[model samples]
Target: MEFFNNHTKLFITAFLLFAGLTLLVCIIPALNNQSNNAPLPMAVPLSDMAIKGKGVFIANGCVGCHTQQVRNVDMDKVWGERPSIAADYADIHRTDFWRNTATLMGTERTGPDLTSIGTRQPSKEWQLPHLFNPRILIKESIMPAYPWMFEIKDKAQPGDVVVNIPEEYLGGRKGKVIAKAEALELLAYLQSLKQTKLPSASPQPAFLYGKVGEESDAKPGATKELNGGMLYTNNCQSCHQQNGEGLKGAFPPLKGSKVVTAEDPELLVNIIMNGYTGREKEGYPAMPPIGTNNRLKAEEISAIMNHERTSWGNSAKKVTVDEVKKLMEKVKVKAK
Candidate 1:
């Protein structure tokens, strides 16, 4: 009894010291950082709706099934970017709070990485439909429908169809209508998943870089190098079509176009490398800038430029590696 009573104060002091240490080491910093270091996405703000949706996301433990970070090895192999950093999370913040915790660093990868999910898929209409019911869009989706997060509504606007809500949903207490605000906020978060680069019109290889360094020129007429055809098929065909007669106004017609078969191939090479818009002299649909597909090699652009000029009735001169080199230099200067 004498020993116990004497040590009681020491034991209490020790316990208090340990608890204080833990609070300072882990709890205090987390609380401080969470209030000050959360992310604020460049695209949109965390409005009341988005905040509510974020609560829903957390309440459902979406992070347990999905991940938001991309490691260096995965980025290099899959998308060619580096891993996540603290700077990337500097967006979410408030005057008094933030959400800067190290989240989604878990063992599960049940769903795809959503770090760049918004940019990966940017269709608001598509996101809404998918959220309404996953099975409708993806037959194999294992995700449960977040019907409770949705509020079914009537046709408030013209052509706005009234979507169905599950009967047991919390939001559908009296079969409440779809809350458009919540849907938009959730979409704002999802639309931010674009992590990959855009598709190129004609991605070229390494050998196409310079003035044919001894390895240039075909082996005695090897059928005009059928290399670039595959690139064209993959990237260009969607708008240009297999026959190259692009959609009337949406995409310019490549066949029989003056720009395609012109005598000087530098213009075409520049168009491919730097991208072209405005009407061609022949008056066709304007092309978009090469914003998405910037990965095409200079040589591939040259080859495809040469191929198009020759194949489509126009006897334009072939665009050589020398020409591509020159034009690429010029484009780089202009880009600067």
Candidate 2:
């Protein structure tokens, strides 16, 4: 009867019981499950720089806008090759004793899902400028810029990474914009977000609710119709405006480019296949090798080229898939 009146003893007894239950029911099973769950064979561990970059990613609140997971739905297919699995994130360890942000599988995608951004947009040239000021890449981008990640210098010192900023975005500051270590680290983390491939024996879950009987039966090398305008919007519209007027002192204009309107489409095709560097001497950043990186099919390349040729007041001869396919083969051979 006296024990029942002791409030301190009662509280201590309740706390001990709760802790025991937690250890037995929650923590113990979690530890066991974690040990059993191994990373996928294809999963690459984060490099030291990438780990630091992951800290930067979390600090910048990138998870608020972007998502790391790709759901098992038809609409999510564009974000990754396959649906995400537990093994994909099994290797992620805790940040620290106080913080348990191990799984950065963010919800509510305010921006595009980053499950396979490394494979989709691997170009550092594109990624750097995008981080500096998304408006430089995407005019209508609502995402805020992180200028603190870079510095402006009158002259780049040795081993300095000089990022090309638009003349207008320089805020009247004179000098080259150089990427700070934080920016490079952030880029490293972003570039490491590739999805792990599943083994042949264990297939991945298919995207649900996709259109029935939409699968194609075309031969592997056969020509197929591709959407040029849509491809342009996806790939090129960021650098070149929809109106074909590129940013002055940054991206070159294609509206009246001699390369675009030339009778000999060979040079144009070569530039598309293997990126152009001559424009870098003109203060514009060197173009990324989109055709190679994207592994665009002949029909897709032809569509993009033809779209650039005929639109925006430029009337040029339409390129064929055969021409591009043969040229691409020659380009690959020449590279060797």
Candidate 3:
């Protein structure tokens, strides 16, 4: 009782009690967890360029807006295929001994989660202008532009990566905008922010509590027409605007595109499967293969094609799943 009454003794006792609780509740369990013993499945140490880019990411306060974690919830399914596990971050180490800036597992989600951004949004074309000016790509974006990471040059020399910025969004600037080394390095870091997949034997499925038994709502033998608008929003709306009028000089507009309304869907289907960059001469950056990246099915591709063809007052023939499947087969054979 006397010891408890004493301030010094009480302080020491409280400290010891908290420390012991921390060891028991936090440290001991972490040490005993099986995940700690599992090897890093897809963890690779950052490259030199990636390390420097990480520095840039930190210096620019990107952590304030982005989170690297994907919670085990149904809503997070759009960001990643599976819930993140302890092994996903097991191999992450400190940037250096002097700094404690290791592991940018941000708490806030002002921007989208980047746990699998490397696979989700891998295109350099979209990332560059996005970094320069978010409004150019996403009209309603609130992200600040980091124009300091780029430079404007009258003409690009050999071995230069020129950023394609639309004239309307250029803010009356002349000359071509090029991403600096810092920007490229930052891109490398962003591209490395992919989640490590768990072993196939042990899978952690997303927690979809409300969605259970929801599939039974559809009546048997009744074919529900695919919602092309919803499909476009999920897959294509990021690069191409909601109106199908893509960003000028960056992404070609699908509103009046001949490709969208072409009689033969071969070119469009091939582009979706393999991606397209032949329009670079016309100032359009290379289009990433959304179909390949998302692993879209033939039916999904058909829906997207039909949506693009018929939307924005263009009435092209609707594409069928069988036609898309045949085109995909042809693409595979050509690759072989």
Per-candidate TM-score against the hidden true structure: 0.46, 0.76, 0.82
- Rank order (by lDDT, best first): 2, 3, 1
Residue-level lDDT tens digits of model 1 in 1-336: 665677887798789999999999999996887677544233344466556655556656877887776665522222213355543554545333565533444457786666765543344434555576665444456877765555544335654433433354333456434546556567665654434322255232112123334555657644344466666654455456667776443356789988778776656666665566556565443443332233556666666676676665657677776667787777667756
TM-score of 1: 0.46
What TM-score would you give candidate 3 relative to the actual structure?
A: 0.82
Query: Residue 220: error of model 2 in Å?
Result: 24
Using lDDT as the measure, which candidate wins? Answer: 2
- Cα error of candidate 1 at position 269, Å: 15
The RMSD of every model to the true structure, in order and in angstroms, is 11.1, 4.9, 3.4
lDDT of 1 at 1: 66
lDDT scores of the candidates, listed in order? 0.56, 0.85, 0.83
In candidate 3, position 59 carries an lDDT of 96
Structure candidate 3, residue pairs in collision: none
Off by over 4 Å in 2: 1-17, 212-228, 245-306, 317-336
The Cα error of candidate 3 at residue 112, in Å, is: 2.2
- Backbone clashes under 3 angstroms, per model: 26, 0, 0
Candidate 3: worst-modelled 10 consecutive residues by lDDT = 34-43
